[model samples]
Target: MLPISKPDLDAETVYTTCTATARPKSVRPQLQQLTVDLNDAVARYDTAAAGEGLHTLGDLQHQPDGKPDKQPGIKKPKPKAGGLNTHLEAAYTNRLVPEKSPGHGFYEQLMAKAPDGRCPLCSQGVADTLDHQLPKVVYPLLAVAPVNLVPACRDCNFHKGDQAPAAAADQTLHPYYDHNVHDYTWLVARIIEPPKPSITFHVEPPPDMPPTLAARVRLHFTTLKIARLYNPQAGPAVRTLSLNLRRWKLPSSQVPQHLLELAEDAAVENPNCWQAALYTALASNAWYTQGGYEKPWR
Candidate 1:
């Protein structure tokens, strides 16, 4: 996961802004009353996230094991219900998400924070939507909380829909708070030979890393199906590398060194990126560097 800076805007400001233009004259007072709850929920979320205790938060207890979309015949809460969860969810879907809404600028502000418009969760897909870290349907109080929203691609958001961690180890890495995970090289890849000349990615935290942190990294990799997302893309990359190697007319003896240089350059940009992992694995593999580039990237 790519680490990003936490939003400077606070929950109260966003909550008040979103609720300021609530439709239906009667619901205005009720939406206004929820401001304090939003503030308290944001505080709890910040504290629990920092302590790795978000799974223990009261709101999580109400989250169902599976999402409505995934579960057959499960219906989502109606917007007209006007209940607490519905109201808050609408605050997001109606007030914050719509293009003409007063709080729509904040939505753009959050999306703009994505590094080069790439989702931090996968660092691959375009960041076009805001995903709730704690799931707004379950933790309605944080529906408009700035810190609870993460910029993500639609695929990442769909893959992570309504997932509530059962424990600290199960929690996916938070970009804002888990910056330390990116401080070292934990993501690595292995070169597969023969039948299929492909590489697979996985997490390999350093020895000095704490066990909990290591578990979190593994879970993050698994939950997002990172290997599945990256392996197919590696095939085209290998084909490109082979074409480039031949185009440059580099000798077999120089292939490994060239691969190492590429790995170093990729690492300079992102230590844990799939490109860095792929090049590092290829540089160490004997067959891949010594004439293995001739193999058709099946």
Candidate 2:
């Protein structure tokens, strides 16, 4: 996962803005009544998230069909049509996500936070949609909470589904709060040899890192299937690097040094990106540097 600056928005502000133009006039007042409780929930969520305790805050249990087994803290509205859940979800889908909605600016602002529109979750896919860090279905009070909303690619969003963590270590790295993960060189790749020479990415948390933090990194990597998402790109990158090396036609002894330079440059650009990991692995592989890159290793 990649780090991003936390949004400058709050729950009460976003909820009130979204509710201002809530449709079905009857639901407007009901949504309005939830402002205080929703804001409280957001505050608690923020606290728990900072402390990595979000799993403890939600009293609702996950159901097989993505329904919340219970709605705690926030009371259901008078509307029988799914009550507070529907209103809050509509508050997001209708009021916040629509192009001309009052909260569209906030939506854009949140999307803009992702560096170059790349999903922080995968750091590769384009971040076009907002994903609820804690799924809105299970935590309706945070349906429109800006802090709870993260810029994500459609694939990562779909993969995440409506799941919430059952424990602190189970939680995926939060881009805003999990900045420390980026400070280390955990994302690494290994060069697989012949029959089909390809690169595969994996996480290797620093030796001195806390065990729980290390586990969280592994969980984030696995949950998002980072290896599966990165390997295909790594293959193309390996071929491209080989092509470039051939074009340069450097001496065999110089190839590893040239590749190391490329790895250093990629690391400078993005410490944990697939390119950096791939190059680092290739640079260390004597076979690849010593005339092996000339072969068709795609």
Provide the clashing-pair count of each candidate structure: 0, 0
lDDT of 2 by residue, 150-178 (tens): 99999889888878888889888888878
State the TM-score for model 1.
Answer: 0.90
Question: Which prediction has the highest TM-score against the true structure?
Answer: 1
Clashing pairs in 2: none
Q: Score candidate 1 by lDDT.
A: 0.82
Candidate 1 worst ten-residue window by lDDT: 62-71
For model 1, the superposed segments whose C-alpha errors exceed 4 Å read 59-73, 80-82
Error of 1 at 56 (Å): 3.1
Worst 10 residues of 2 by lDDT: 60-69
Global Cα RMSD, each model: 3.2, 4.2
Query: Taking the tens digit of each residue's C-alpha lDDT, what string does model 1 give over 36-62?
Result: 766676788888888887887865333
